[model samples]
Target: MKKYIKIARPDHWIKNFFIMPGVAIAFLLTEHSLKDINIFKLICAFFATCMIASANYVINEWLDAPFDKFHPTKKNRPVVTENMKFSVVIAEYIALIAVGVILSLLVDKLFLITSLVLLFMGFLYNVKPFRTKDIPYFDVLSESVNNMLRLMMGWFVVTDSSLPPSSILIGYWMAGAFLMATKRFAEYRMIGNPEVAGLYRRSFKLYTEKTLLASALFYSLISTFCLGVFLIKYRIEYLLCMPLVFLLFSYYVAMSFDPDSAVQRPEKLFKEKKLMLLVFVIIIAFMILTSVDLNFLHRLTSNSLVWVRLD
Candidate 1:
């Protein structure tokens, strides 16, 4: 059981949190009553995504086992440590993919499309010919595309229409890209060998501290702008919460630059108590402020007549 859990790569499950933003943005934009929302369908979408993502991780680990054995940190993974058999991992992958596909099909056509796209992308990331991560820009592009698909999956599950060019979605995408770039930067700095970096990822050579810093700064600015726009568009009084977003981005960028502090594994930062506390505090504060003026903000902008009269 322990081996199976390790093989499942529970640490990667954190990525599933991507589902929340779409649901939150959809609710914020549409103002749909909670009772009317189909929570079950959303849950199904979340589960299906988790299964598919986990399967991808398993396959990736299996394929990279040889290289991982040389990685300073990744060498400790169950697959690398010989705690799990490749055959068992393969079986799990097949089962996960099967269940993920069936569950996704049960939802809607949009869900089916998103699931298939994710599966194909995962295969392309790991397999040859279309091994996107081995290419130059395609590496970052593939990661960003997957992130966008995950965000869209949630939006499709909730609302049948295509997601609008909302500030929240844009902000989320920028943040995701920023994180991806930082991950590559950190890996390059930690390994100190371009060949090893390239072994793990194809875009490692393209990243440098200066380039990464610039990219991070650009994304941070765009994210902040998008969040501000979201608040204004929705007439949300919690625009003040925008500072928390800035702080979070700044903290991560600061850590990413410090060789000792910058964790090679991007997911490790989330597990750190101090970092998690800071994130928790910011989220709690934002929630409180947003909830406080919720009704008033809704009333001020919800009625079409109110906007016309103001004009």
Candidate 2:
């Protein structure tokens, strides 16, 4: 019974918190005031995202068991280590999806559709015939799409009638891609053998450490550029948070180089006190930026020339 639960990988649900930024951003942009926001619906949206994510995890674990056997630590996952009933695993997957659908229905139509797309992406990623996870860079891009989907889910929960700014969505997608690429880079480094890593993940067949690092850099650049557009277009105050955001990404990249890096186990990342502290600071900064009117910051975006004299 516990093995069934473990296969669902509830710990990975922390990734669903990606939805929070969407919700917050949507609330800030929408006509709805704070009093108009529905806390119950927000909770429902979050849990719905969790359930669908768990459903995906269940299928992923079951399908990847064979490949995971080649992985050092993943070889011990419940699916790989224990005798699992195929029927039970399928049932669990369906049950989780059902729960997610029910909860999503309570949130909004757009949320429900986005939740279904997230589930479908899991199939596209883990299932045969069309498993994009086997296709090198596509693996990262496909998996990273979940980040944008979660953001959309959060946005719809608050205001299904409107869409988030495309700049922010693009920025969020590239940020997720950057994170996924870094995870791949860390995993490749930890494996330390291309052949072994390739056996564990088909995409690794063509992914050298250098290639992954290069891709990560590319994604980060795109992310920052689009996010910059978002900050400038929506609220110049957010530009203040950009430096800390860059610092956060830089710190994450540095940590990926550590021996047996924590980047490999994102769920365990909370144990990194410094990283968590930085995240907390960034969150506080965002909250402050969102709440206050920093109209003066717009002057920085103006084309006005400043008078200067060289001494």
Each candidate structure's TM-score, on Cα atoms with residue i matched to residue i, is 0.81, 0.95
Please write out the lDDT profile of model 1 over residues 150-263, one tens digit for every residue.
877877777766564567767777777777777766766788887777665655666665776677677768768887887777656767677776787777876766765644
Model 2, span 22-98: residue lDDT tens: 98888778887668779899999999999999999999999999999999899999999999999999999999999
Clashes of 1: 0
Model 1: residues with Cα > 4 Å off, grouped in runs: 1-5, 78-90, 161-166, 258-263, 289-311
lDDT on C-alpha atoms for all candidate structures? 0.74, 0.92
Q: What is candidate 2's CA lDDT for residue 14?
A: 82
Scored by lDDT, the top model is 2
Best by TM-score: 2
Q: Would you give me the overall lDDT of model 1? A: 0.74
lDDT of 2 at 85: 99
Worst 10 residues of 2 by lDDT: 302-311
